[model samples]
Target chain A: AQSVTQPDIHITVSEGASLELRCNYSYGATPYLFWYVQSPGQGLQLLLKYFSGDTLVQGIKGFEAEFKRSQSSFNLRKPSVHWSDAAEYFCALPSGAGSYQLTFGKGTKLSVIP
Target chain B: EAGVTQFPSHSVIEKGQTVTLRCDPISGHDNLYWYRRVMGKEIKFLLHFVKESKQDESGMPNNRFLAERTGGTYSTLKVQPAELEDSGVYFCASSPLPSGLAGVLSSYEQYFGPGTRLTVT
Candidate 1:
C-alpha cells in the first residue's frame, strides 16, 4: 500500500521567515508525489508535483519541493513565508495504476505570525 | 479555459437522508474523477469516468453510493441514506485526455474543482 505522512500537524512561522514542511511517504514502488494547498473552506490547489526527472520542482506562489528517493521524503519549502501562505498543506502520492486517485497525508496547518 | 466546476457548495442534510452532488468538468476533457475528505482526514478517491462509462469505481465505500456521468460532459454522485460518516467535502477533477503510462510518465497534474461540502447531522 501507498501512504503519505506529514510529521508536523501544525507549524507556526514568522512572516517573511523561511519555511519548511517535512513529508515522508511509504510505497511499494516509485511514487508520483504532489503537494497541494487548501485555504479555509476552499478546494485543494496544486502547489507542486514531482513525477520524474528533477528531484527539485518549483511550484506557484514562491513554493518548491525536493524529492529525495533515498530518504523517501518530498519536503515543501518556501524562501519567505507570507501571511497569505497560512493554510493547510497536503502531501500526496497517487497510486500508479488504472485510477489517478491520490492518497493524501493528514495535512499540516501552517500559521504565519506577524 | 474554464476549470472544473461543482454545484451545491454547501449542503446540510440530516442523517439517513439522500443527497446528490454535481460536477461539470472542463470542456474537451474526457477524464473525470470524484474524491472526498472526511473530518480531519485525507481526501480519498471515489471513482473515475472516462466518458459516459466508469473507468474505475474501486474506492466507492458501498452500494448506497452512486455516480454517473451523462453524455460525458457532467457527472453526478448521489448518496442515499447518508450516514454521519459521509459528511465531508467532495471534489471533482478533469483531464484533457485519458491518462496512460505515456501521460503519467510525462505530466502528473490534474485540475481540481472547487468542491462541495456536505454536512450530515
Candidate 2:
C-alpha cells in the first residue's frame, strides 16, 4: 500500500522568514510527487511536481521542492514566506498503476505572522 | 482556457437524502478523477474516468455512490441516501492523456476545481 505523510499538522512562521514543509512517501517504486496548496475559500493549486531528472524542481508562487529518492521524501521549501502563503499544504503521490488518481496526505496548515 | 469547474459549492442535506455534484473538465482533457476529504482525514481517491467510460472505480466507498460522464464531457456524481459519514469536501480534477509523442511534455499534473462541500446532517 502507498501512502503520504505530512508530519507537521500546523506550522507558524513570521513573514519574510524561511519555511519548510516535510513530506514522506511509501511506494514500491520510484514515485511521482506533487505539492498542492489551498488558501482560505479557494481551490487547490499546484505548487510543484517531481517526475524525473533533477532532484530539485521549482514551482509557481516562488515555491520549490526537492525529490530525495534515498529518503523517500519530497519536501517543499521557500526562502521568504508571505502572508498570502498562509494556507493548507498537501503532499500527494499517484496511487494506481497509472499516474492519474492521487493519494494525498492529511495536509499541513501554514500560518504566516506579520 | 477555463480550468475545471464544479457546481453547488456547498450543500446540506439530511442523512437519508440524495445529493448530486457536477464537474466540467478542461477542454481536451480525457482523464477525470474524483476525490474526497473527510473531517480530519487525508484526501482519498474515489474513482477515475477516461472519457465516457470508467477507467477505475476501486476507491468508491459503496454502491450508493454513482458517477457518470455523458458524451465524455461533463460528469455527475450522485450519492443516494447520504449518510452522516459522507460529509466532506468532494474534489474533481482532470488532466490530458499521454500523447506518446516525444517533446510533447505529457505531464500528469491534474487541474483541480473548487471542491463541493457536502454536509449530511
Candidate 3:
C-alpha cells in the first residue's frame, strides 16, 4: 500500500524565518502528491499538488513544493513564515483506484515563534 | 459554489449510544468520500461513493459503522454502540467530473469540510 512519511513531528520556527517541511513517500509509481494544512478548529485546506510536469509546484498562501522523483520526496517550502502559518501540515498520497482515496502522513505540527 | 458541509460540528455521546453524522457534498459532485482521524492517529479512509453506489468500502473498520447515500446527494454515517476509540474528527470530501469529459482521470483534488468532531465518553 502507498504511504506518506513526515519526518518532523514538531517544528518551532522564528517568525519571518524560512520553513521547509520534509515529506517522503513509498509507492510503486509516482502517484498524485498533495500538501494540506489544518488550522486549529478548521478543515484541511489544500496547499498544493503535483500531478505531472513542472517539478516545482506553487500553491495557495505563498507556499510551494518540489517533486523530486529521485529522492522520493515532495518537501514544502516557504521563504518566510508567518504567525498565521502555524498549523498542522500533512503530506498525502493517492491510495485507491483512479487515485481517489488519500493516504495521509502522521503530520507535522508547526509553531511560529515571535 | 459551496464547499463540503457536515452536520453537527461537534457531538458528544455516551458509550454504547448511537450517533449519526451527515455530509452534504459540493453541488454536482459525483464522487464523495468519508475519512476519519482517530485521536493521535493519522487520517484513515472510511469509504467512497460514486453516485449512489459504494465503489470502495475496504477501509470500513467494522459492521457497526454503516454509511448510506440513498439519493446520491446527501450521505450519512451511523455508528451504533459507539466505542471509546471512535472519538475523532470525521471529514467529508467531494470532487466533480465535468460533462463531456467522462472516463478521464484528471483533477483529483478533493475539497474538504470543517470536520465533525465526535467524542464518545
Interface RMSD of the predictions, in order shown?
A: 1.7, 1.4, 1.3
The i-RMS of candidate 1 is 1.7
Candidate 3 C-alpha lDDT tens digits along A4-107:
99999999999999999999999889778999999998899999989878999999999999999999999999999999999999999899447688999999
Q: Kindly provide the TM-score of model 2 when superposed on the true structure, using C-alpha atoms.
A: 0.97
The model with the greatest TM-score is 2
Give the lDDT of residue B52 in candidate 3.
92
What's the DockQ of model 3?
A: 0.78
lDDT of 1 by residue, B25-112 (tens): 8888788889998988888889888888998899999998999998999999999989999999999988767367576543346778
Instruction: List, residue by residue over A1-114, the lDDT tens digit for candidate 1.
Output: 888999999999999999999999998777889999999877778999887798999999999999999999999999999999999999998765544777889999999999
RMSD of 1: 1.9
CAPRI-wise, candidate 1 is: medium
Q: Show model 2 residue runs off by greater than 4 Å.
A: B100-107
C-alpha DockQ of every model: 0.70, 0.77, 0.78
Candidate 2 lDDT, A1-114, residue by residue in tens: 889999999999999999999999999998889999999888899999888899999999999999998999999999999999999999999884565779899999999999
Model 1 misplaced regions, further than 4 Å? B98-102, B105-107
